[model samples]
Target: MIFFEDTVSVVKVAVSLLLALASWLLIRFPAPFRHYLNPRPALTLWVSFIGLRVIPFIIVYLIMDFAPRSDTEFFYKKAIAAFAGKMVYRDFLSYHGPLFGYLISLPLYLWYNAKILIPFMAIVEFAIVWATWRYYQSSRPDALLMAVLYFLLPMPFVAMILSSEEDIWFWGVGLITLAYASRAQGSLWIGIIWGLSMIVIKSMIIVLLVPLFFLVDNKFKYVLGLAIVGIPSIVILYLLMGDAFLMPLQHSGYNMTPNIVSITRPFLSGVYNQISLTRLNTISLCITMALSSWAAIRYRHLGYRQIFPSLYVLTFGIFMLAQPSAPGFYLFMYMIVVLYEMVKIEDRSFNVQLILLNFLIVIEPIIWVIYVGMLNYDDWHTVFSSGVNTADYLIQVVEVGLLLALVWRTFVHLRSLDRAASQSFAASSQRTGSSPVS
Candidate 1:
């Protein structure tokens, strides 16, 4: 409905949606275009992937430019007495991260009255694609698929491309996390880059760090590397913004609760007013996270490289249940990593697992749309207003389903690792004819 806001004709919206969905279908399942989808002449494939990310970005940019901005982006238009020559970092209020806002404005301050976000975002996206392609040679095909998936699915992409907002930093952290994880060596510099990126865009990159921590081979090197990268960036942020530097962190922690009860209560027609308690959610999340960590530690001997997928599962699973909000964005990004693994598996038995995983991948977005509509029924008039909102009740259900599905998968994956470990241990003991030393 909002897509037709610019035009009074209803037919236009129908046409636009049809075209968009058709484009999406082709993008998601470009099987008929296998020559294009598969490895081709290097130049042709590179151009095709670039076209995929850039063309959509351009389309969205045009739409956002045509649309009007809400007052939220320019909340402090007047000269603020509090921040005379400084940047604002009001808690939950500021739209962009401090660094992002400044960087976004730098070009505008120099070039003209135009927005700096779209072009800067396009550049950042291109870099992420380049880096991902460089890191995962075997999965370059999947990486191209991932690049499209990232833009199409992530909330940050919507904010950056469709709304012309400054959420480009989310992708920056996402790429960094993936790139660093894929690398054989552990680097402190990359860790700090990731940590700071999370500080700015917590929802997008926070859980990705879990994989890095668990996957690094040397514990001291891992901890030291991350601390060196993370600690200084934080300290600098504090020095530059003082209390405001803490604002983002505080806001992130505040929303740590999984709001499952609140969102789902009305759908069940239950009388419960508040969603499940944050404390309870937090405790459950902690327990789940601990179990995931144990699973990683237990299976560390399998080699650090194998643990990346497990780390992602554990990280994203815990996060989805930990927070009450839609896990769509985080789950979607992590699915890219998960799908890549699924394709790499040669075992036929894992086909059942593949089917289930693929089912979730396909249905999650559609379910989320319905769930959003249900949860926000009271605000029905504003459904799909400025941003996409579905029925509030439906959103509640999908959120719950997504959270549970991920957690269930994490436990299953952990158990698989445990079984594999036990078999390996038994075989070694049999060969030695002695009880194996721990």
Candidate 2:
């Protein structure tokens, strides 16, 4: 069922996938690797982690000089354009945040090449791994296990090694939110940081910011802080770009392939028919905020410090699920933050689906980019424009199903906390021969 006659391409895809599947099998049970992993020096671990992110792409694309996977790395071009004294929305058609154009491009100024972005992204990812370990330190996650799965997982691989995607900026705001909540610091710094994050990263931080307003204890202060920084920063941006400041924020209307919208596109019209970006963004935004607000209320009983896991996961997970713009790689951040929690779940069926979900999501982009439209993995425009064939469509159906299952599993796990609390209360009441609290 290969569309185009590319044996070499098939081999490349097959070998990479098979190797991932094998490594995933190892993830099912990491007990045997513990003796070896636990004894390793921390330096060795860090070096190995960095090596995994860089080496494969280095050999394939850097040394052998394969055709670039897609124009993902060229995102620095937005930054590059701004550095050369061009206005963002007027001088160039870019979907990135206004300041992000400058933020990512700063590396290119130092070196003046896209390869500079590779190292820049590497540093960003290294910080992410370090952040993952540091934030979960009290939970005492198995460092080696975290690194191994994080390494083997295809989501980050697709982002870092295959194509240099900047969607990890999703993690930037996400991690910032986590740190702010974990510390329970009532400082106005978060409002400032979040303000900076909106302009510096994608405006999707608005999604994270909404639930965060309720999840933290400092609601009034948070609101005051946000206004202090966010309001004027936005005003300045509007003044600078005019209505064009809304351009990047409105970018989500162009559906990224392999999202829920892709599944529905064929039915709405022909694959090429342009749907209303405004309508799609409005509907998805409403869905994202409604679900996130509900999740905030659900986790409100827990202290801010304790609400990070369920709150962040559900809020972001639903946002990713509901949005037409979020690519499968967006889930790259989800697995890193939630993998340890998924691993601890005792349900074998859920664990198996969790592993497959990670694997399928990596393939999600591949199927959309390579398989669906006859290997048109050349540019984001072409890739998103491509239509799904029957084979690829079937695969997306399964991916969506698995996503629903995992999100439900996570919700159930969170609900159990409330159940346990209620049970403990009832038991205490009974022991004291008192009326059980409703």
Candidate 3:
């Protein structure tokens, strides 16, 4: 296959799996792995993340002379346009959030080079790891180990360092919000930040916020957050961009692979070009709302922070599968949550599921690229465009299967929490000589 820059993407895939394999072995078999590096696990994880990111960065940027591809380059152009005084939705075009352009362009404003984004994302990755370790260290023995596994989850590593996606920041913001609410110090600004982040980051972020409304102990904060922050932000954007700010509402984009559309493409060839984004958007939105509402009602007794780890998997499952365009980079945003929850479960089956999911996701783009030989979609023949077509469909099946496993596990998790809450309430009632009203 003709890969980007003659082997950059292929080699990057290999490197991603290497990092994942190394992390998998170390985490799965801690005894022998720790025998050599048990002196200071903290420092070891830091070095591992930094070293893994920096080394490939050097080889790709300096040695191979590889430049920013697709998304990264596209972001830079949008930022450049914005810097030149063109309005985002009104003057030009963007499928992402309003702030994506300005945010991605910060490197250009300071360093005047796009490559700074690589190291910038590396630093963000480290900071997220640090935050996870700091939060879980008191209770969990291998908090940093979980962070390391997340860092090397293959799709995330490739997305951050190679593709330069900013989706990880979504989780960063989530961790911050959860940290505050968990401590009972949540302020209006938390809501504002979360509310604004939905516009600034991605609309799919609302999946996280919607459940928080049901589960968070501080309903006033989220209620006012969406109201005080969400309304004014919308009015201002509408004022600024007029009808253009409502681009997301229009659902003008087409379907991509690994979605309901692409999944059906192999058989329903006629529906390929005829696929309706508006219809898909409607379906996706319906699915998201039903899932979010069900989760909220099911877990109303629990605190948001208490269930957020599994919440990430549950909500993002809808985010990934229900959406018209499901980018695998979305996994990096909450892979750590899945890792931490799986650590609590300690089930070998979950371990297999996590590994297989990451492996399939990491190669998802490569498989599509190999099959179509390009990123742009031209016609209905795209699915059967190349010889790798059959293998691609099988890979897509496994990918979907692994994601569905997460859905099942999340249901099991929420059910267990519900039972625990019920039992605890029953015990307390017996001690107090009282009974539930029902």
State every prediction's TM-score relative to the real structure: 0.63, 0.84, 0.87
Deviation (Å) of 159 in candidate 2: 1.3
Predicted candidate 2 versus true structure: per-residue lDDT over 163-262, tens digit per residue? 6666656655656765665554553556667767766766777877787777767777778877887788778877887887778766665566554766
The lDDT per prediction is: 0.48, 0.66, 0.71
**Which has the better lDDT: candidate 1, or candidate 3?**
3
Give the Cα error of residue 14 in candidate 2, in Å. 3.1
The ten-residue window of minimal lDDT in model 2 covers 374-383
- Candidate with the larger TM-score of 2 and 3: 3
**In model 1, what lDDT does residue 257 have?**
18
Angstrom error of the Cα, residue 387, model 3: value is: 3.4
Ranking by lDDT: 3, 2, 1
For model 3, state the Cα shift of residue 110 in Å.
Answer: 3.5
Question: For residues 282-305, what per-residue lDDT tens digits would candidate 3 score against the true structure?
Answer: 677678767966887678767666
Give the CA lDDT, 0 to 100, for residue 14 in model 1.
Answer: 41
Error of 3 at 167 (Å): 1.0
Question: Taking the candidates one at a time, how many backbone clashes does each contain?
Answer: 22, 0, 0
Which sections of candidate 2 miss by over 4 Å? 1-12, 67-71, 141-143, 182-187, 259-261, 264-275, 345-347, 374-388, 420-438
